[model samples]
Target: MSEEFPIQPKFGPFLRLFLHSQLFCTPQLPTQSFADQTVIITGANVGLGLEAARHFYRLNCARLIIAVRTVSKGQTAKEDILQTVKHRNEADAIEVWDLDLTSTASTVAFAERVNKELPRVDVLVQNAGINSKTYAVSEGIEQTMQVNVSNTFLLALLLLPKLTETAKSAKSLPHLTIVTSEAHHLAKFPQINTPDIFESLNDEKFYNGQSSYEISKLMQILFVREFVSRINAKNPPSPSVIVNLVNPGLCFSTLATRNEKPLAARIIGSIIYKIIGRTTEVGSRTLVLGASAGPTSHGEYMSDGQNQDVESWIYTDVGIRAQKKVFEQTMKVLESRKPGLGYAVGL
Candidate 1:
């Protein structure tokens, strides 16, 4: 039987719960024996994305594409996975592709490649995202917003056709899993505004550190809920595909720390993390759960491998309402942009 926690966690330190809980038995989860399914995992070079890829590979999923920004690093990750999984052949299983979600051009190129070559993509995990030390701009938008929100939005839109096609052909189902964060619980709401814009590259105000990180995470959840609603409205009962969001419980893996402070500062942080963070294996469990076939709540947020039936009073309604508005705005932005791009910028 699947495990259940009697004590639901609070939003601020949900990662703490994620790090500390053994929410489910990995061995008992569904296997890839289901008809060959193709899954695309972003940010697969390391951290949660890499771990998630390994999970899919073990299930013997048809084709697991590692869509990463660093193509070379991605290749190395592919090698590592092959080595880690016993008796696994390199071909007919895992592949790598270049995808820098921060750039509209790159997002487009990646989508085009997938649309042209792959027959059907069963899962598109929007796992690639970033946070910078100082403020920066990507594709003319705030760096965090661009990578975490806009680019993600664009990629989801571009991949919709393939997702739709796969949903129709397979007769089973397709899913879009987004790697969101518990930090979203802190966001005042999901409405995108001028203040929400990253002021400038290296803007210290934005980088006081924790605040910016939390804000980006908040946007991520909003994006997930927003996308789900749109998919339902546009596609209807055929539903074809479903979108779900997850906050991989805080394991001590680098989300944006790869670009963080001085070596000493990073080391100190790592030490602190060692004291609190979960292993990569533990942190990625919920993400893997989100991607798998299950009863995923449409237009809802999930944490610790299960849906949060009752949210904190402060966040309960705002999170939902804000996500709805943000979804509408995101569609308008995507609808207005030129076709053939993975992400559209300029607000």
Candidate 2:
């Protein structure tokens, strides 16, 4: 690696990206089998998460867990998969579990359930996140930051033991993949200069709906880098848990255009989606790729089908400063949710 970051993204503009999408293609669907792997995917009721779960089940993953906010929606997603894909073992092959990222209590309970019921977890796809234009709060925090960044990592860390244990017992490199976006590079991160990123983010007076999602995505990437550094902090790592962040690119997803957006915004978004977005099915392939990635991908960013260097800005002086600040502040907030979680997760 050179002093400069590798492969700084060249097509950062919308027009260039749209033209690129027009010329290139989504990730070629993975035909690799996931046999014997117990895979868990968040927000699997629809969109990328649901389609990703479908691929795993189609590839003959032994056990599939569709973690969702509502069990009913998950059931619907499961039934859709069963009807479309031919399954050999019919009953209990797929389990639906409740996971509400908006609430710390819910996040904690969900992890506890996984620890209690699941024999092992080979892959965890953190595909559930929000991109809304509305200002809302959950559990006394801004909803977007809570779901997309805070609780998301909390769930991952809470389940670290399960992932590492499965790695050792199954002789596999378990994966913990977080679904992020290319828009992270566009984040102004209005809170970066503040003494506390999370605290500043909580100041509703300064909250921006548009940049909030981008900031959260950026935070996810930053946090993953910091988290991996700690995961193997002491020297020899515990059982290998390949942690990765993936960008599915802009895709046609109903989740993002739901009531959380105004009609005008939704209409404009729909037009943009039709012009340049890949289908949810196509986008999900990237998630599957990220989840199946090997040890070399640890602490790396995966896009389309392979590891890509993050934007050069992320390696710049400004970006490095922002990264360190966000990680330190994030840990302080997360520690309250799970005391000594850094140590618990082998930090």
Candidate 3:
């Protein structure tokens, strides 16, 4: 693999990925049932997120919330999941909630609803994300950066208290999993010296959708590192909330080609996906594993149902500086949305 993108299957990483993907047996199912547990999955209208919802429902989770941008689409997903359930009574266990990751206001509204409505949240799967071929802006920010990095963690921070409370009351660790991507290894850590890293990312002169998407994934990983550090540094140390990042690898889903407008690009993507991509069912297993993982998985980067090591570059001096910069900028943006929010979360 290229030195900058070491996670690609081009060198020793290729062999590791090959063994993990092709040689491994089915992922180990969760030994413990989700009985009476509440699970929330974003982007559950389709793809891996929808498949994860099915798996959680089958595990008999007491309350399953499918959060999506479109209520109708989420309802359709809930109905589809219900079709596979063994009993009709289980239909009531699933509810569709509205969430638009493009808007900070929408994310905060969703978080408020969750805090007010849900009694507890045992597992939170931050699975919603987007990639676009052309430049687009949402809420005055680049679409990919807004959805994948800003709003994604905005929702997570807003719900941290609930996760902590649930874990403390139940005497069990609650999981907060953010679905990341191997593409993160490609990030160049642009604008490291800028005060507003995200604003720099939004500048059109340096824009490339693919690179922007990769950088957003990198930001997610960095956020996880910073978030876990802050949680550990709390006065009493909040061990109850276990946050993790997971990469499902390339999967045969619309997520890969949804933004490719050119017919040629779409055709080539489809062929590549057919040849190497895992099914959505298999890809979703990684998300489920991350959600059900234990304390050992805290702040870890998991892939192929295991806590694998991240790229060595993440530990380099330059990488650490970039991570700290991104983390500080991310907190500033989030706290700007709600004053004192970072302090409230112990950031």
Candidate 4:
């Protein structure tokens, strides 16, 4: 009876504050519906990428291609998405294909398959990434660098024609959306200086226990800028393609558990993480935004929920100044590998 006499709504003040803050906030939301657009989100078996696929489908996405390293996992994820949209108005159009972003042969093969099967890829989300304590190798390159940067770069390059085709065919030109990370700032600029990255992939003894993950992420942003420049140089003005990068804020997921830290260390880290770590759903927001939105700016680095000009953050503009060198080095690494089964540049 006393409470009823003085009932006050909790969060009333906070709600008022939020409403006031909205006046100063920037507008959000895509200009158009995602229907009829085909999006390929890598590493969609789980984590942020998986969440993106689910949300996109919920919004009645025309097609969702979930690229996974594991075939069984991919199949399972496909089934789950189908179940969710089972009662929806449109029939399910979700697909899952195998893609290992560590091997050149694998990346090329996946690209070739996509070109053959997918007439248009409206959005390409480079969401798959890896980090490690010791320098690991894949296809004669550091695992972190290769998977996060080199392999991703090769895939993007290989699919350029298809992406262009998709854009040309689409009502609205398509976009290339890449998922980089805030950890990029921690890297010592993008440099292929560490030849050990190539030598250490096969020789664990030669591998230094170092974090190449940050460097790889740095290279990712650099690669995006380079790719955009190359496309512009080769294409006419007012090209249909748009390229953008996004950094999903820190999230609690398998990426944290990947390192084999002590039990107490893990517990303490998790507790601290719980205090600040964002949910997977929140982390996927920027990716969805970048993928669906047309070119707000070319080669923009969307991080911390803000799109920062990556060109401003560079410590050394050497790579930017020497586009040809960077491109040649990347192509050299990719072409060095023997063309394995089902691997080809063009259909």
Which candidate gets the maximum lDDT versus the true structure? 2
> What TM-score quantifies how close candidate 1 is to the native fold?
0.81
Clashing pairs in 4: 136-143, 137-201
Please report the TM-score between candidate 4 and the true structure: 0.80
Candidate 3 overall lDDT versus native: 0.83
Displacement of residue 227 (Cα, Å) in model 4 is 2.4
- TM-score of each candidate structure, all chains considered together: 0.81, 0.92, 0.92, 0.80
- Whichever of 2 and 4 has more TM-score, that candidate is 2
Question: Residue 190 of model 4: what lDDT?
Answer: 22
lDDT digits (tens) for residues 1-347 of candidate 1: 42221212265565444444434422234343433889898999898889888888877778999999888999998988888888567565888999997788898799889989999998888888775666666656667777877778788778877886897777467878878876655554322333333333235454544556666776566666655555565554545666777777556777746674888988887886776666776767677777764645555566666775323532555445655555655555555554533233211
Error of 4 at 138 (Å): 1.8
Better of 2 and 3 by lDDT: 2
**Poorly placed runs, candidate 3 (over 4 Å):** 1-26, 29-31, 235-238
Candidate 4 lDDT tens digits, 1-347: 13211212234443443333223333243334678888888999888888778777776678888999998998787777767755554434788888999777788789889989887888888899886776555666767778877788778767766887887678877877788876655544323443433443345664432446665666677656766666666666565767788877677767777789888989998986686676777677777877766466567777544566443335245546434444556666766653421144231
**Residue pairs whose backbone atoms clash in candidate 1:** 108-342, 135-201, 135-202, 184-218
Across residues 152-230, which tens digit of lDDT does each residue of candidate 3 receive?
9999989988998898676468899999988776666545556677788889898898888888898899878877876
How many angstroms is residue 220 displaced in model 2 relative to the true structure, after the best TM-score fit?
0.2
Would you give me the overall lDDT of model 4?
Answer: 0.68
